[model samples]
Target: MTGLLIGAIIISFSSVMVRLANVPPDVAGFYRLFVGGLGMGLFLWRMGKLKHFTLHIWAWALLSALFFVGDFFYWHRAIGLVGPGMATMLANFQVIVLAVVSVLILRERPTAAFMLAIPMALAGLYLMVGVSWADFTPDYRVGVVYGLLTALFYALYLLSLKFSLSKAGADPLAMACAVALLTGVLLGGLSLGQGESFAIPDVRSLLALATLALICHAVGWFLITRSVQMVRTSLVGLILLLQPTLSFVWDILFFDKPVNGLEIAGVILALVGIYLGSLKGKRGK
Candidate 1:
């Protein structure tokens, strides 16, 4: 639980790090995955487990990487447009998306609490932006769309990753490393196609990107993956919420994001809904 808490805190700084790097979205995504993947590969090599991945694992990792490419592309753009707080919060709409997918495709029945959470979350979003959405600029509207797209892609990534982990003898670390490296390659190609530079601008930007790669992607994810299974599922859901919550706080503190009373209420309501949506109810005997 401590590890989970610490991991969440570490990841909460990811948005700020991206902003500090101030690079093109694809550039930031490429470095984050490439550097983080290298770190994980080194760790696995040290443990004598780097060469053990099966072809099946590699295939699944490739699929997961595709989804993650979409995830980072939209998410980073949203962060640049909407400010980190709202962007992070909007991306977390993945919980709701996952819930809906479980119900529709997996043929699972949602709990009463989960059913109730859906409308509450929508209401929260309405409060956050729908009230004066037309008054906002087109770029801001596009950012919101990108944020929602991030949620969709993130949900797909989670589903693919879950399936990958279910394979026999699948090492989570190795799978993560594969996905990160592959995604980095894809993002790098995309960056080049878009004419984005690969060079780091300054020492501060370099440090920020490096910390984002090693700390948030490598250390933070490792901690969460290691500690999550040991904790209660419900508790894990709640604890993981800290990432988005702290991200919102960091945006306000670091970027001085403008907020109103309605927006605060919306954030609270949305978070509560996300938490409720993440919980699994007991099956009947």
Candidate 2:
């Protein structure tokens, strides 16, 4: 619960960081991976377990990094295509993707309440976007596709990262450091291939992006790692349900965005859906 709460708070700052960042989305993605990796390095140095992590762990970390870094790139691009509110929610639709994956991989089914509320949540989200779409240009559909893909990849990232973290054992500091290095290397290569500029960010964007790397990415990843250690993956999904909610609230508070009647309905519906999903875990606990 502590870890989940921390993750929620960390993620709450993410879009605000992106909104304030004037850098290209691809460049921002690069910094997130690399700079976040730097934070992990600092953690490992302080803990003195740096040498225990191996190349094999790095392989998994790099794989996880690729999925996430790729998601960030597309997700940020999606924000440009669509508005931040819907894009953030849509991209976080990863939790639903995780549910589908669990059905296939873990042989689990959602409870009745969850099933009943999912479509409502989705419908509320769709209604939110449909209104946005109605007002926005038609070309923005490209972002919707990107957002969908980000969710898929993020779900897989959640699964794989946890598996690797478990395999790496309780040395989260070590795991974080190794993965950060691996992730940074991958994102660096990606930035190079994309021909993104190496131009230093202005003071405002740089400060914001650095804070994002520390709080939103580094601290957020650390907290989520702790959550994976403490809870079952099933409830991990439920805990992650906080992210979109946080994202929505952050947009309203910091971005000076207003939610419409239906958008509020969507929020209520999603909360109900998440509540239903959480009931199974609560009963077990």
Candidate 3:
């Protein structure tokens, strides 16, 4: 439980760091993953587990990394366009996307709880964005679209990671390193293609990106994975609810973003819906 809270708190800073970097989303994502992969690679090598990456694990890890890159790319864009809180909350829709994918590909039937959650989640979204349609700008709509795209790509990442884990054999460390390295390379290439400068313009940007990589990516994720092994699955799911909620708070506190009553209600409804959907997924399994 402590690990989960720590992880969530650390991850809550991800958007804050990205925003502070003041770089293109692709560039920020690239540097964050690259630095993170470098540090993780060194740690794993020092632990004598660097050579454990088998062909099978590498194959799936590469595939997983591709989706991960897409996830982060759109996620960062969403954050820049809409603000961290809305973007983070929108990205949680990946659970719904995953449920749909399972129904189509895995032939898993959706439970009644999931069916009910569908409307609840949509209602929350309507309250979050659709209510602002009278004053919505093109950029705002684009951000919302990117947020959904982030969720889609994130669902793909989750599915690919699951496959990679099954094929990773005994060396989870190696698999993780391979995925991170590949994701970094892919995002780096993307940044170059977009003609974004990779050089940090100032020390402040450098510090933010470094913190994003080391603390948010490496430390936070490590804690989340460790907690998963120690805590009950249901509790873990519930604890994860804190991440987006705290992200919202961070945006308000750090960025001076204003919140409305409707937005607060939307957050509550979205969380309730997500909880129900996840519970149904567990029961279905």
Candidate 4:
């Protein structure tokens, strides 16, 4: 759980890193996966099972990458469009969406806590982006729509990951490798789709981007899997709920972004909802 918390915070810093890297979004995202994949491969080597890994598991990896590609673009675009607070909530909305799938398809009954968390999460989202929606009117709706698409795709990505990982069987590190490789390929394709040519990053940005790819995607996903294996899925969701809060905190710490009362309240609501979402019921998944 503690690992998850640290990982979440690291993950939260992603947007800042993305912006700081000062590269085109697709290019930055592609490098992120490539770096992350390389890190995971190195980690797998350290585990002494690198020789045993093969193409067989790559199908899962590619599927994982597909979801990630959708998620990466959406999330990247989202932070730019909706602002971090609401974008984080919407991006994290995958938790609730995943929970519903678990209940309906996997027969993981909905906990009362999950039920309570829904409204809290919605209220948090409302507080985060409600008034802003009014400002859109007819002029900025495309951006709003793009943001909504981001949230939806993000949720799908989470579900695809959790489901595929649980069904596909492998250590978290190995899964990380598969995911990294897959994400790299897919992101590479996306970059090409956007007419982006791959090239070496600047010395400073490369170093910074390398750290983020290693920490956020590599260690972050690894720790999240560890936490889920150790804790209840619902609780795991709660632990990750800190992601948006951490994102907000990162902005304050690094960019000197101010947190007004309303923003603070929105964050609090999101946190509370996360708590409720994490709660275990008498009949829980």
Model number with the top lDDT: 1
How many Å off is the CA of 208 in candidate 3?
Answer: 0.7
Ordering by TM-score: 1, 3, 4, 2
Question: Can you give the lDDT of residue 275 in candidate 4?
Answer: 66
lDDT at position 110, candidate 4 = 79
Better of 3 and 4 by TM-score: 3
Question: Which rank order by lDDT, best down to worst?
Answer: 1, 3, 2, 4
- Cα lDDT tens digits for candidate 1, 51-146: 767787778889899999999999999999998888899999999998888877777777897888899899888988888798889999999999
How much is the lDDT of residue 248 in candidate 2?
74
RMSD of each: 1.5, 3.5, 2.0, 3.0
Enumerate residue pairs that collide in model 2. none
Candidate achieving higher TM-score, 1 or 3: 1
In terms of lDDT, the poorest run of 10 residues in model 3 is 276-285
Task: List TM-scores for all candidates, in order.
Answer: 0.96, 0.84, 0.93, 0.84
lDDT of 2 by residue, 166-239 (tens): 77563666666666666666666777898888575689988888887877888887778757668875567667
Give me candidate 2's TM-score against the actual structure. 0.84
Cα misplacement distance, residue 162 of candidate 1 (Å)? 1.3
lDDT of 4 by residue, 101-217 (tens): 666766767777778777987787677667566765453355445555766676676667666667676565776677777777777787888887676467778766776688887
lDDT of model 3 at position 218: 78
List the candidate 3 regions with Cα displacement exceeding 4 Å.
280-285
lDDT of each: 0.90, 0.70, 0.83, 0.69
How many clashing pairs per prediction, in order? 0, 0, 0, 0
TM-score of 4: 0.84
- Clash-forming residue pairs, model 4: none
